[model samples]
Target: MTKFISICALVTSILLLTSGRPVKTYSELYRPQFHFSPEKNWMNDPDGLVYYEGEYHLFYQYNPKGNEWGYMHWGHAVSTDLVHWKNLPIAIYPDNNSTDKVKCTAWSGSAIVDKNNVTGLQEGSYKTLLAFYTSRGCGQRLAYSNDKGRTWKKYAGNPIIPEAPGEETRDPKVFWYKPGNHWVMVLYRMPGGDKAKEGISIYSSTDLAHWTFESHITGYYECPDLFTLPLDGDSAKMKWALLGGDGSYMLGDFDGKHFTPESGKKVLDYGQNFYAAQTWSNAPDGKRIQIAWMRESKYPGMPFTGQMSFPTELSLKSTPDGPRIFRTPVSEISSLYGKKMDKTDKNIIPGLKNYNLLKGIHNECVRITGVFDVKSSNMFGITVRKSRKEAGTEISYDVKKQLLTCIGSQMPLAPVNNKIKLDILVDRASIEIFANNGEKVITDNFTPAEQADDMELWTHGGELMVDSLEVHEIKSIWRE
Candidate 1:
C-alpha cells in the first residue's frame, strides 16, 4: 500500500522538476567551495549514509521546490573521495496518496548491503542494497537496490514495523550484528501522549522485514546512531557509542540484544552547527568515517540553504575527563593541499606587531595548523578573511579562562602541557576548528566581506610562543 503511494509521489516530483522554472546558479556570494550542497534547493539531516563498491553514497533531506524547507525528499549524491560529490536524482519522496492521510514525507534513515540475500530482494549475482527510512504516517519502510544503489524499488511489504500506539518514532539506523548473525536497529522514539519518554529504542530483525523490540535507552533524542570504536586504536578493546542529533554520545556495551551504558553522555563536537550526523556503513577497510548536516545558519542569496561538514574520521581515546570521542578530517583532505606557508618557533609580542607569514594565503579557502604556547598572553589567536580590523572570523584561546572561542561561541579547554594545537579549515562560508588534535572541535558559518582575503595573527596584553604554524591553500572540490 505504501509502496504504491511512493510511486505516485516519485512521478509527481519528476514532472515538477522537469517542467518547473529553469534552475538558476547563484553568484558565489556565500556559496561553499568544498562543502557538499545541492545544485539548488534546501537540504538538511544527511540520511542513508553508506559506502559500497568503491563509492560513498549520501542521501539527504531535501526540499526540491524552494529554498526553505517544504515537501521532503531524499536527495542523492555519490563520491569516491568524500570531498568531490556528484549529485544524483531524488531517491525517496513523500507518499502523497498515503492511506493514513497525513501528507507524509520521507524522513531520515540508514542503508546496508545484504550480502547474504537475507531479505531475498537481490537480483542477478549482486548483493541487494537496502535502505530503511521513516515514512511519516506510515512508520518504517524499506527500499532496495540491486545494481549498486543506482536505482531503487520500494518493498511490497513496507511499513515493516507499522506505526504503533503512543510511539512517535523515526530515524532507523540498522547495522549487522555479527555476534548474533542478524541485524540490529537503533531507532529514536519519543513516546506520545502524557507519558513522554525520549530516547533510542533497540529492535532486532532476522530477515530485515520482521522486527522484534529488544530494549530501550533513555535520555537521547532524534536521529540516533550506534557504532563501535576501538579505544586508543586498540581493536581488542572496542566500545560502542550511541549518539543523537545534538552530538551527545554515550559509551556502552552491546551484546546484540541490549546496550549497557559504561559512561554517561559526552559531547562529540563542541560546535554551533553540527547536527544529525551519520556514519557510512561498510566503509572500505573498516573505516569509521562520518558526516553531519551543517545546520543553524542560512546561506544568504545562494540557491542552496545548507551545507555538510567535512567528512571526519572518528576514534575513542582515554582523557583526563574520561573516555571521549575524537574527530579529525579524513586523510583524503590532504589531497586538497596547495601552496604551503610555515612559521616555526617564533615568539609573538604585543603592541600591534604585524607578521607577514600569511600575507599570501587564500583567505576564503585554506587549512591552517598552529601550535601556540600561551603561558604569557591573556588572549592569543589567528583571524582569517579580514578585510579590515573589525571584519573576518576569529579563533582564539583565552588563557585566563582556559576556553577556546570561535566567533562568539566558547567551549572549555584546558591547555595540554601549557600548549594548544589548533587545526582550522576555512571555506567560503564556514570555519571548522579542531583544537588539541580533535579532542575539541567547533564549526560555525560566517560571511566575510567580498574583499576580505587577508589572514593575520594577533595577541593581547603579552607575548606568546609559536611552536609551529603551517598554512596551506585548499583547492575547490567543485573544480576538481
Candidate 2:
C-alpha cells in the first residue's frame, strides 16, 4: 500500500510539473462555426500531406513561443474526425541555429508516403514518408519521416530544388499521375518582374532524388497545390485543379508535361477567409478533403481569436450555370452540434417589428441567418454585438453587389466588402458571413475589447426583412 501510494504521488507530481501552465487555448473561443489551431502558439499555412494509418495528421506553420506568427515550426495535431481537435506538442522546430544554415522558418510544404519506394523503382520503405517544403531564404528542401511522422530528420545536403530568381517560389506538392506512371511535383514560382500572377512549377521525379523541371501549372501566388477531381462526378471527365493564394482554384487538365486549365478563373472558395489551400486524395475513402490556411488577417494578436471555415469537403457539383465547385464543412464539425434550431416564422425577416428578441442563435454555432429582400439600399444585414451604438462590429452583405462585409472586434477572419446579403455567424471573437449560402463570403477580424457579448441589429436607409436568423453558443472554454 505504501509503495503504490508513493508511485501514484510521484506520477501526479510529474504530470503537474510537466504539464506546466494549462495552455490558454483560444481555439474554442473563436466561434461555434470553425475552430482552428494546428496546436497553439501561432498557426498560419496548413501543410504536410498524408491521412495514413487511420489518424488525420494536419501540420501547420506554428510558432511555439508567442502568438505572433514566427519561428516556423510545423505544429502537428491529429483528428479522428476533422473537428474537435486537441493541441499536441511541437512536431518540427528549427534545429539548425547557424548562419550558413537556412534559419528562420520552415515556410510551407507537402508530405507523401513512399511506402514501396515506387519512385526508387524498388528502394524499399526504410524512409517511406517524404516532406517537401520551402526553406526560408533558400528555395525548397526535403525531409523524410520514417516512424510515422512523430519525428522528422532533414535530408543530407538538401535543397532538392535550387533558388529561382524571385525567391517567392514556395509550397511544394507531389502527386503521382498513374496514367503516366511517374511522380510530379507542383510548386509555387513567380516570374522575375511579374507581380500579377504566380506560376506553379511542374517537376518530374523518376527516382525521387533526381528531379527534372517540366512546366508551370497555373499563374498563382503564395502556397499553391494541385490535384485532379471528377469534373462531372465521372472519372471520364476529370479536371486538374490547383489551390492558390487568393482563395481561388485552377481547373483544367495535366497531360504529362503541363497543367492546362480551361480558364484562368479561380474555382471559388466556400468563403472569404480561406486561402493558401492544399488538398490530397483521401486515403481510405478516396474523397478529396482539402484543407487550407484560413487567415484571420487583421486581428493577429488578441487573447481571444478567430479562424477559417471548417476543413472543407470539396466536390464538383453540376449547376445550372456550370460545373460549380461545391463544398460543405467537413463532417467533424457536425459532432459539435447538439440540438439544432428549427426553422420558423419567428426566424423570418422584418421579425415581429424588430424588437431585439434574444432567444437562441440561428445555426448550431451561435449563428444568425436572415434574408432581407431589400427593394433598394445597403440595409441587408445586422450588427449583433454587445451594444447598438458603441465600438461593436456589424456584419452585412449587400445582395445587389454580391459582397459580404464585417466591422468591429468579434468579426469573421475574411475579406470585408459592401456588396451582398448573407447568413452571418457572430462567433465568439469572429463572424462567418455566408453570402448566398456558400457561393460568396467575406471573413474579417475585429478587435472589440470590452463589450464582447450581447447583440444588436442595425440597418441603413432602407429596412431589412429578416428572412431567418439564429445564434449558437458552442460549449467553449472562452465563451463571451
Candidate 3:
C-alpha cells in the first residue's frame, strides 16, 4: 500500500525528465552502488522473487509515469549472480477495463516454477514460471511466462480467486507442499474493512487455477509470507515461519491446511526502513535468500525514489530465547569486493581522538568488518561516511544498556562472549549493519556531506581490544 509521499519526490521530479526506460550507466548521486534500484521512478516491495534456469527474476512494485506512487506496474530485472542485474520490460500492468470502483493495480505477490506442469501451461523445454499477484480491489490473479521471464501472458481465467465480499485481500505467497501434494497460498486480508481484523488467510489448491479457503489467523498485516526452515542447521528439525510486511515474524508448525503457532512474534530487522521482505521461490541448493524494500528513504534530485536492500541469506538458529531468524548478505556479494585493508590486535584508547584507522582509504562504497573485544570500554564504535567537517554516522554499542545504536535507531543487542562482531556494508546512500554474526541487523539510509568518506574506530571511558578489522572497498555494479 502507498503509505505517504516523500518531500523529496517533488524535488526529484523537477530535477530531470525520465525517458521511461532503464539506463545502463548509474551516475546519479545517491544511487546505490550494489543495491538493486530501478533506473528511474518510484519502486517498492520486491515481488515475484524466484530463481529458474540460472537466472533470478526480481519483480517489484513500480510507478511508471512519475517519481511518485500511482499507475502501479511490475518492473522486471534478472541477474545470474544476484549482484549484477539486467533490467527488463515491465512484467505486468493494471487492467484498464476493470469494473472495480478502486484502481486495479498489480500489487505484491510471489512466483513459482511449475516444474511438474501442474497448470499445463508449459510451452517450452523449461518449466513454466507462474506468478500470482493481487489485482488490487478486484482479487488474486495469475500470469505465466514461457520464455524465462523475457515475456509474460496473463492467464485466460484471470482473477482465479474472486474478490472477497466486504473485504480486500492481496499479496498471495504461494508454495508447493510436498507432504500434502498440493499448493498453499498465504494471503493478507482486511476483513470487514477493519484494521483490527487484519490477518493472513490460508487457501489450498490442487490445480494452479482454482483455490479453496482453508483457514484464517488474526495478527499479521500486509505481505504475508509463509515458508519452512530447518532450525540450527538440522534438516530434521524444521519449523514454519510466517513473516509479516513490517519484518515481524512468528515461528510455527504448518500441516499444509493450517498453521499452529509455536513462538510469539519476533522482529527480523530492527531498522526504520526495512519492509515487505520476500524470499526466492524455487531457489537452488535449498537456500532461502530474501530481499526487502527500504521504505521511507528520500532520494532528492534523482529519478528514482526507492531502493531494495542488499539480498540476504536467511537461516533459523536456536537462541537463548527461542528459535530466531538470522540474515546475512549472500556469498555472491564477494564478486564486488576490491581494495582490501586489514588490521589485528590493535588497541583503541580513549585518548585516541582525531585518529583515523582509515586515513588513506576513502571510498563511498566499502565494507567494514570489525571484531572488538569489549575489554574495559563502556562505549566503543565506528564512525563511517565521515569527512574533515562532518562526523558521519556512529554505530556504537552501550555496555550497560546492551543496546546497539546507529543513526538514531537502536537495537537491543548483547555481545556474544564479550566480543562484538560487526559486518557493515556502506553504500552511497545506505548502511546495513549485521551485528553479533547476524543475530541483529539494521538498515539505515543517509545522504553524506560533500567529500564525506572517512572512517575511524573509537573508544570511550577506557581501552578496547580490536581482535581483527578488515575494510574492503566495493566495486559499483553499474560501472563495468
User: Which portions of model 1 show Cα errors greater than 4 Å?
Assistant: 1-27, 96-102
**Please, what are the lDDT tens digits per residue for candidate 2 over residues 195-248?**
665577789877666679898654577777777678767988877776677667
lDDT of 1 at 447: 79
Q: Which residue pairs does candidate 3 place in steric collision? A: none
lDDT of candidate 2 at residue 302, scale 0 to 100: 44
What is the per-residue lDDT of model 1 for residues 108-210, given as tens digits with 9 covering 90 to 100?
A: 8999989889988888977899999988767899998988887888899988878777668889999999989889999988766323577888999999999
Once model 1 is optimally superposed onto the true structure by TM-score, how far is the C-alpha of residue 362 displaced, in angstroms?
A: 3.7
Residue-level lDDT of model 3, residues 313-358, one tens digit each, is 9999988988899999999888999999998998877876644566
State which candidate has the highest TM-score. 3
lDDT of 2 at 105: 61
- TM-scores of the candidates are 0.92, 0.76, 0.93
Q: Which of the two candidates, 1 or 3, achieves a greater TM-score against the reference?
A: 3
lDDT at 164, model 2? 67
Ranking by TM-score: 3, 1, 2
What TM-score quantifies how close candidate 1 is to the native fold?
A: 0.92
